[model samples]
Target: MPLGDEPVSFTTMVRGREIRYDRDAINAYLGRLFTLPHGEELCAFQKQLSRGNWDIPLMTRTLLRRNGGFEYSAAQNPLRVLRDEMATFTQLLLLLVLHNIQPCSHT
Candidate 1:
């Protein structure tokens, strides 16, 4: 697979269930997502996740569509890029927690 060149249609088996997704629709949705403001997109996604109204394919589409509130990188592995963003967020969260618990003193 190459950047911006996903299969138009694909199928796979998951947990004994067959799944199919149209990459065209995913791409269209991604295009629309990118048009929205950064905060708006994330708020919408968070709301959806809280409602537990998402599936693997839907999540996949959303993750692939996201670019961490920055310009789309056109990376070969969008998922990996998303994972890296998640790691950064996790680290930031840890730092926040530690800061709150143990404030740093000025040198």
Candidate 2:
């Protein structure tokens, strides 16, 4: 587990070489990604995904708000599409971690 506001760091071996993944760079990338108008909602969804209790459809609707229904096609909305892709990637990564298929060694 990471301390409050601490950049997450972990190590994994691939092809007999250890690789370190530090979240500082990843966080920078994510920070840039969330600079759009729907950044808040996307950030909330990202946090929810991190906690393993995300609501995808609700997030989709929230991102494309209009009269309590989606105002646009999700495929046409980059933010919504990104949310979905992030959710999928997060879920897959979680499964990999849980299965020890891509073990992340804490640094």
Which candidate tops TM-score?
2
Residues 1-107, model 2: lDDT tens digits: 67999865586679998776655545665675324365353566687667765555775554432323323465643222432334455556657777786656764
Residue-pair clash count for candidate 1: 0
How well is each residue in 1-84 modelled by candidate 1, as lDDT tens digits? 235967444656699986765555566756753345754645677888677554644544444434442233467222233335
* lDDT (C-alpha) at residue 94 in model 2: 57
TM-score per model over all chains:
0.17, 0.24
Residue 43 miss distance in model 1 (angstroms): 29
Error of 1 at 32 (Å): 5.0
Mark the 10 consecutive residues where model 1 has the least summed lDDT.
76-85
**How many clashes (backbone N, Cα, C below 3 Å) per candidate?**
0, 0
